[model samples]
Target: MPQRTVDTVIFDLGGVIMSNGKPSDFASRFPEADRERVIEIIMGPYGQDSDHPWHRVERGEITMEECRSLNRDAIIESGIMPILSTMQPQGQESSSTGGISFNFSLSEPMVQLIHELRDNDFRIGVLTNNVREFREWWWPLMDFETVFDTVVDSSEVGLRKPNPAIYHLTMDRLGATPSRTAFLDDLQSNVDAASALGMHGIRVDDDPSAAIAQTRLLVQL
Candidate 1:
């Protein structure tokens, strides 16, 4: 492990430290879909100031229940649902996905790594674009009190990632600065957001061991 002058480590929840718990079938709905296309159609393109239903849910302006209903209506009314319905939902893919996966389980390796970081005095935090019902399912993954010093969930904060405000808020909660924090996420766009603000953005996807190694490299006691 290589040591750096980092005081805090911020991680995204869904794909980084957790097995992205999306219904395996939902992902296979569009086998040939490109990442960009999936975002554009599923929840509008990535960026701040989105009126997309997912954004609204993350912002706490709408509930996840409402977002799902709205999504189905829009897809059906726009004739997108007919096309989607024809495709059979297959097994899940291991590649990067720009959307949120509601089904998540804790990764033991990640949990151990986090505990080690915490024990070493590195402030640990989680910045996730999660739904309102997140605690119900995610709490069992790890003991939040022992592992995380702060957690900024989009649904409660009315802010989401790739947006500058959320990043600032997270750093503020951890009492760290942009340069002193190391951020990790599965999405390039979210990583870019953190990088733009001077945080070390470590990207992880598909392969957990490689991702963990990358994190350990930057985080040495």
Candidate 2:
């Protein structure tokens, strides 16, 4: 067999390995008219890591409760709180905490692909911009230790995607060179960041088939 150009594969968790629960997924649940604004307030600018409440939470600088308080204040100030309140179900009580919940399921095809890559001796890792509070809920969805060589969670590491430091850190953990690593993420900005750093970055869409195909090509699998 010819030499493979890529030996390490890095994945973003929420939209790539997990079927749902991305920030966009949460925004999608809101009415179309309010979706974009809701996403902006709840997730901030995803392409850049700043002191936004959500970003701070992901970096472990703030607890989820504090993030929720900040979100509530922002929402109230935006005057959208009343609109959101009116959208609640007639019988259901509104939650005072401006918190978002995520329910995610493993992406079977991605899981299978990971196992195949492992069998082929390619290193696998996860680099996710995630909340500390969400670990318990999403951790059990996969046999992470058995599949991935390393799992880098932003909250635990105090860094998130689009911040070049985290990507460098992940590659360092895997003992991987940027040119020999393939990174897959559902967000274009994250993918672009990795690509800018000389990693072969693949953008995953709602349907992951294209991204998987691209990755296979990159590693010559």
What stretches of model 1 exceed 4 Å from their correct place?
1-4, 21-26, 29-38, 47-49, 77-103
Clashing pairs in 1: 21-103
Candidate 2, TM-score vs. the true structure? 0.90
Query: Per-prediction TM-score, please?
Result: 0.80, 0.90
Error of 2 at 60 (Å): 0.6
Candidate 1 residue-wise lDDT, 83-190, digit = tens: 343222355322212223334567777777888898888999999887675566576767776669998988889899989899999999999998888998887889
RMSD after CA superposition, every candidate: 6.0, 3.6
Model 1 Cα shift for residue 218 (angstroms) = 1.5
Alpha-carbon local distance difference test for all models: 0.73, 0.85
